[model samples]
Target: MLIPAHFEDLPFDPQRPRAPRRQLRLESEGSTASGETARVLIHNISTTGLLIESAVTLAQDERIELALPEVGNTAAHVVWMSESFYGCRFETPLPASALGTLELFSRVISKAAPSESADTLPVRIARLRKEQGLTLEALAALVNVSKPTVWAWEQGKTRPTPERIAALAKLLGVNEDELLSGRDGNALAQALNQARQVVAEAFGVDPARVKVSIEL
Candidate 1:
């Protein structure tokens, strides 16, 4: 086994509480069968499963291999995906011991239960704009852009450039990260899974049945 030479031992702090459960953003950058490098964000993951949101579409039951920096590598089955995102369940469980090494590189690592909020950039922009009490026209005036541009931002059909993001942050009195990336990929996956269960229960069927037949 190759031990990461950079991992350092820190005195455990009881009060710190194992940090929050580190959330991982799954990213895929490889050529698909059609020969295009598909980039995707891995929304959520456990030892047994992973939720991915990618630009490329994957059919259910399609088998694919994944390159994980932490867990070495593995294969997965496409359990679900939309035009822009997909969820996958691993074919096998990752070794528990690997979690420790993974924590070192993860963006969000802690012990808390994974949050289940569904975050989308457009929804976040709309919510923050409303919270700040900035009218679309007012925001447009502040950004020196047209009102229609602001509308497109809220609708999520397009993304603002770095300069536009800076302007939006200035108008909303928030940071760039807040204005740009409010949605947590992991949280969104949990919400999707929960919602799927609730709907399945209401309809008196297994969740798997619903997924197999549901049209993307």
Candidate 2:
């Protein structure tokens, strides 16, 4: 389960140390001048939420879509914002695969090895759906897909289409990226290496940079 210690209505102090910034584009906070897509820089992120720099002014609790690269378009919620930066949380806490993706992009460059056929994506799907208390038939009916299709998805005999991935993410309350990739021990090691930065936080600070109120 995820904790509500994000940048929501919770108590926030703007003196926390944050992870390195990441450059990526995604869809969220509604349509922009260039359509519904918004290109933003991620300041910090965790399993629970992320802090990003965006021009979009998002109201509290506003839900939006994001086309995460490698990952997919996922539903996200705005918890709080200050200046050009906003704190947002995934509708569902991201899975390890999605976290690995974040860890990959947070760096200046990344190289990934091909994965084995015995990937964890299918396992993740099965686990998430069961956690949601939906049987194969029930989930298939909910998504207008056949039971065999759902079974294939769970068995890794096939993968979901982008559109279906979007639907699955929303239906299962997860980030689309979390549904897209699966990894093994190597990916886990990389994620851990990328996440080595320790947080430095306190209550007081100068007004120059955006005060880090929440921990990632």
Candidate 3:
């Protein structure tokens, strides 16, 4: 051990179990131990562990589930926390080759899903617009509304009238109730559950394995 001063810069360690750890920055949806769902930004991840940054406060040893890229719904326990930053160790370690690679994930979702309903109008509209490859401005122009108005609809800020709802539903190829069903989280759990099935089909995965939270 005393004869290795010149090898200090070498990033490899023969004593370590595997290859060096790599880093990735990605976004995901996580459910807290308290059953609250929030958006989380994954700062870095490896087969054994990951670091997450979120607005939600987490406690030490709290159990949480993260919908990770490539990997599916992975259960982890919070090993450490400091305000909005937390560290975790996966309940079951992933394959060494599976970590730090969202570029591959991007390829997997390159083909958009077909028109389908979602848990809320905002989610439905957002999903439809993405499927049709339309941006906010484009959708707004086609709908004869301001960009903010379209955004408002996507955020559940305001629900359109029945006539407007009909037009939107027709435009998105979804039923009106899919858009109006949950004005604001009114029994959206059921709708989101159904939407997960559609998402699974769209991505050619099993419904139970769809961990990305079926977003808009």
Query: How well does candidate 1 score on lDDT at residue 96?
Result: 76
lDDT by residue for model 2 over 1-216, one digit each (tens)?
111111212123354223221223432321234443434556567667776656555667666555554567566777886555567888876665776655544443212211334447787788789989999999999888877678668855468888988999788877777666643445655555434422212324333332234244
Candidate 3 lDDT tens digits, 80-179: 8754556889889987766545434433323442223546567878877888788989887877776656765775545666777787767776667666
Give the range of the ten consecutive residues with the poorest summed lDDT in model 1.
Answer: 1-10
Candidate 1 matches the true fold with a TM-score of 0.35
Clashing residue pairs in candidate 1 are: 19-110, 19-111, 20-110, 20-111, 21-110, 22-108, 22-109, 22-110, 26-42, 81-86
**Cα shift from native, residue 128, model 1 (Å):** 9.3
Instruction: Estimate candidate 2's alpha-carbon lDDT, on a 0 to 1 scale.
Output: 0.58
lDDT of each: 0.58, 0.58, 0.59
The best candidate by lDDT is 3
**Each candidate's TM vs. the true structure?**
0.35, 0.34, 0.31
Q: What's the residue-level lDDT of 210 in candidate 2?
A: 29
Task: Name the candidate, 1 or 3, with the larger TM-score value.
Answer: 1
Candidate 3 regions off by >4 Å? 1-37, 103-216
List the candidate 1 regions with Cα displacement exceeding 4 Å.
1-37, 108-216
lDDT, candidate 2, at 16: 25
